[model samples]
Target: MIQRFLAPHRTVAAGMLGRLARRAAVCALAFGIAGAHAQETSSIVIKGKDGWLFPGWGSLTQVDVRGIDNTTRLIGQARDLLAARGIKLEVLLLPDKTLFYEDRLPDGQTLSPEVKARYGLILCKLGQAGISTFDDAAVLRQLKASGQEVFYRTDQHWTQASADATAEAMARMIGRDVAKLDGRPGTGMTLGPLFNERRYGDLAELFLTADEKKQVGREVYSVRRQAESSNLVDDAPAPVHVTGHSMVQPYFGFPQKLSSLIGRPVSVNWNPGNVGPWIVLLEYVESPAFRQQRPQVLVWQMFEPTFAQGPDASGLWDNASIMSANAWLDRLKTALSH
Candidate 1:
């Protein structure tokens, strides 16, 4: 009797209808979002340069033609300007943290050497300009080989230890002895904005194991000197100046670390910008307050993507001071002589 009642129309008709409607809705969304993929040879067969399978969906967007063409001119101008200001400028293009973890590309596809070379060319061009750049990939690989980790696997920024290594490298790049750089002694009292505020926890969750976040922010950040000739005495003065991205700010104790290298408390102009990082960096260094610092060593930290975008096409902020960057360059030139 039950079979006869169910067999009147079909089995599980309502359940099947719900599933079909849901699938159709999802497909409609995919078609709406990635309409370009609608031109596939088959209803479900889409092909790419390497028989690339889209699996459930395809990326219909086209690659933009713009990339790193004018980095040289902009960097050359900034370097010349900074040099005139009597600063020793060093540029370090931090590698995309995703490049190493293989997060950007599809699974099972190894990052090709061509991709790496494309990444490396930015540094190569900087070298051609007679500007010193720290090779992040090389340094990261070396540190890993030495049983010392440089980056958190998931985060896009460096670990404090990595930041320390970077400070040392910057000192060497500026012809200053790395031994002079020192880590700030921890306050041994309380933590700073990082832990107290819980900023960057999402990104940190990717790179840090459970143990790494414990070391994120500190107060004193004291360090025992490793460089015999560079040890900090009881009352040494901080250094002239430091300028870079959020990476070099004192909260991570980068200023103190660099001061240890330079045998003083390193002043800094670190602004994390919504505009391009270089413009932000350039604007800060050229500012009157920052200008007064009179640093001999100027540390510039940017990522590979900055080289890709370059300065010619940079998004200028409404308040961007690049208009006067030229005059600042002239001032910097005079500083270089001092």
Candidate 2:
């Protein structure tokens, strides 16, 4: 006992190491908890009634949002530049719901009805200037009245179901009659479990968030991988060419899924962000290579928000290599006539 007591430094050093080790463990645990917490919550705050989700802060009709000046003149110049280089430009704008429903917005919010009208005016001005833009505002308003959900619950993107509707709108825009393609596959045994867990976007992160994860909603993906040769749609497909932003990218595969929808195999281009729809549209219209192949249908994938303001420095018109609005429009007209 006396010898054990004689080793005085042993007790002090051992106690110090124990406390340090415990503190390190606590710190690691705290980090893990914080990370999980973030995953459960929405990074962007969106006030939605019931459970429906939608594109927030990125649509065309936001109140007090920034827009470019001399929109008409700029688009004309941009179009001419693109057409000379052989491209086609079609513009569409996706309006924001919040701007329209300012009265219903959370208290202390400044968005108002006048702001909505102002944004609408901007859209009208652009359309009158010859952009061949889709009548999205009317359609969206109608959809809203009918209680149809167009946007996702957790992400800024529209849902696959909404995409299907958009695809139908696109087909109609090009003057083709097409049946809506079914994103789901035939047969239960053919598809995998991945299809059952349809959560694809920010919702996935929500599923892992600290506060929301436990109660985070679970919704399976509307589209799933089918067997090697399963039927996804009911009819025969026609060759289609789609140009737009990332909103249209799923067109590459989704079309192939529908029995009547097929990709052109002509290798169209795509860009993301809030814009870039017209760039690829212009590319397909101007390139002789694209024209020679002659895709039977031209589907323009667009989001309305980018269309309201026209080109900024980062817009497709600014990039000399990818997008030109004028020559591309001429080529588009030619392609349409031919």
Most lDDT-accurate candidate: 1
Tens-digit per-residue lDDT, 210-238, candidate 1: 56445542222222223333323332222
Cα error of candidate 1 at position 311, Å: 4.3
lDDT tens digits, residues 211-330, model 2?
Answer: 553343645445444345443442322244455555544422323222222221212345554335444555555565454554443444444434433333243234643333444445
TM-score of 2: 0.52
Model 2: worst 10 consecutive residues (lDDT sum) = 1-10
Model 1, position 78: C-alpha lDDT score: 66
For model 2, the stretches where C-alpha displacement exceeds 4 angstroms are: 1-72, 78-88, 97-107, 176-196, 203-209, 213-216, 224-240, 251-268, 274-302, 308-338
Instruction: Tell me the lDDT of model 1 at 50.
Output: 20
